[model samples]
Target: MTDTTTARKPPTSKNSEVHVKKRRLPDETGIFIVLVAVLLVFSILSPNFRTIDNGFTLLVNGTVIGFLALGQTFVLLTGGIDLSTGANIAMSGVLVALVMQAGVPWPAAMLIALIAATSLGVLNGLLIHYVRIPPFIATFSTQGVALAIPLIITGANSIQVRDIGFSWIGQGRIAGVPLPVLLLLVAAVIAGLWLRMTRQGVHVYALGGNKNAARLAGVNIARTTILVYAISGFCGGMGGMIVTSRLMVGFPATGTGNELFYSIAAAVVGGISLFGGVGTVLGAMIGAVLIAAVSNGMNVLSVQSYWQSLVIGVIILVGVSFDTLRRSRAGRPVFAKRPAVDTPSLPPSTTPSKS
Candidate 1:
């Protein structure tokens, strides 16, 4: 005779197995692919769009937007926006020219203008952090001030830049590449590295991700806010300088055009979420290139300016709408959710019967 016995197996714990999700490609990847596709399409559509010279022109034209978008990336990462960027450009350009016209060296004038523009950024920070003002109200109020200051100072007239050396910033080329494009590339690399490698950069992300959580994590909210806005201001100053240099004149109307829209659109399109805490500088740069290409391509095809504006407007809506949808669903699937790692089920175990 034999007795049969069976042993029951213990329940498997969910924590026993680790689910390491596959590494995601950088957020910039999709945008980069899109950019490549755009370039290809435009190249096919117009022979003018395929020329190396036109390629350089695209980069040169996009430089100002790229600079503004870089700064906007920092600000957006902190869940803030600066509508004053365009105005800051006008202000800094006018101030630098006015200073140079007043017998100051161009370099010195540029420095002063940068300082002034940066100070405005600091003001935005102070108001938002200490004064308890909303980012929109704060930046919009300052935008009006910035726009008016340049107009008021210049008496609504353009200021001529007599210093030929200053033109190098915008017009000069090295190794056949435009100076502005090179400067933008260098700045983008540094900005990307800083965001990925620095402590403050992490804080910027944390703040944007969840402000109260970031605060509890010992992130200095005030400083991060101020720093981002200040960066935005500095970028604006750089844009102003480049444009002023290119034109050899500081016009109050310089950045008052579609620049502000293009920069914001570029930032959002490049993968910087409008809801914040989800973007990269590299992505923003890609977006800038895409925007520049679209604009340039339109011009190559002789599309009207109004049509260009309409296309940009549509792009902005699409980008922001997608961002908003993502934020609303946070960690859940909206359009396409973050890919999930499948956890395999464990088979049941049993002891052999004794006979």
Candidate 2:
């Protein structure tokens, strides 16, 4: 007689090995495609759109907005918004003009303007981080204050810039490229590299991704917040200076409403998430280019200004909607429909008879 015995293996837990299928992260490919499409459409619609002079005009017009957008990207990545950027530009221009008129050297005046603008940014950060004010409300209040300072200082008047040296920053060209455009490119490159290649940049993304988690992970939230806003102010101030240089005048209302709208639009359209923690400076620059292209194309086509505004509004809505969708999808599991694989069972064993 022989006896047969078999041992069964215990079933593995479903959670024992989580096979998470890796999905590609959302990128700025959609925006880039839109940009290319817009370019092609405009080129086909208007014969003058491809001309060099028109191209220069588009780039020049885009410079100020590009600078503001760059700064906006930094703030947005930190899960914050700055409505005061335009005011900073206005205030900085006004202050620089007033200082220059008072016999200060152009360089010194520019420095003072930058310092003032950066100070306002610092104030915004302090208000948001230390005082616990909401980013929107805080920046909005600061915008009013910033705009008022310029209005009060210049009595809502324009100050003509006679200093030729200062004007060169906006109008001069190096190797056939406009100075302002070149500056924008340099700044964009620096910002993009910093965001992609540095530890601080990672912290900004991490902070925006989850504030509490970032805090637990040792991110210096307060400093990062302050730096973010300060950079915005600095960029705004630089933009104001460039505008003043280009126009040969510094008006109390230089940037006005256009500043806030265009800057935010550029960043948003460039694929920066309003909810924060996702975007690139290069993308923001491309967004600025797209905006400039649209405006230029509309002008060439003789479209009404009001219609242009409507179009811009539509673009913003579309960009934001896309961002929302991308974010939502990113949050969902990639293997939601993955098929289960059954664990193999052990075969029964036949024992030899002990006869």
The candidate that achieves the highest lDDT relative to the unseen native structure: 1
Q: Give the count of colliding residue pairs in each prediction.
A: 0, 0
Worst 10 contiguous positions by lDDT, candidate 2: 334-343
RMSD of each: 10.0, 11.8
**What local distance difference test score does each model get?**
0.85, 0.85
Taking all chains together, each candidate's TM-score versus the true structure is: 0.85, 0.84
What local lDDT score does residue 83 receive in model 1, on the 0 to 100 scale?
A: 91
In candidate 2, list every pair of residues with a backbone clash: none
lDDT by residue (116-206, candidate 1, tens digit) is: 9899899999999999999999999999999999888878999999988889999999998999999999999999999889888888888
Off by over 4 Å in 2: 1-26, 319-355
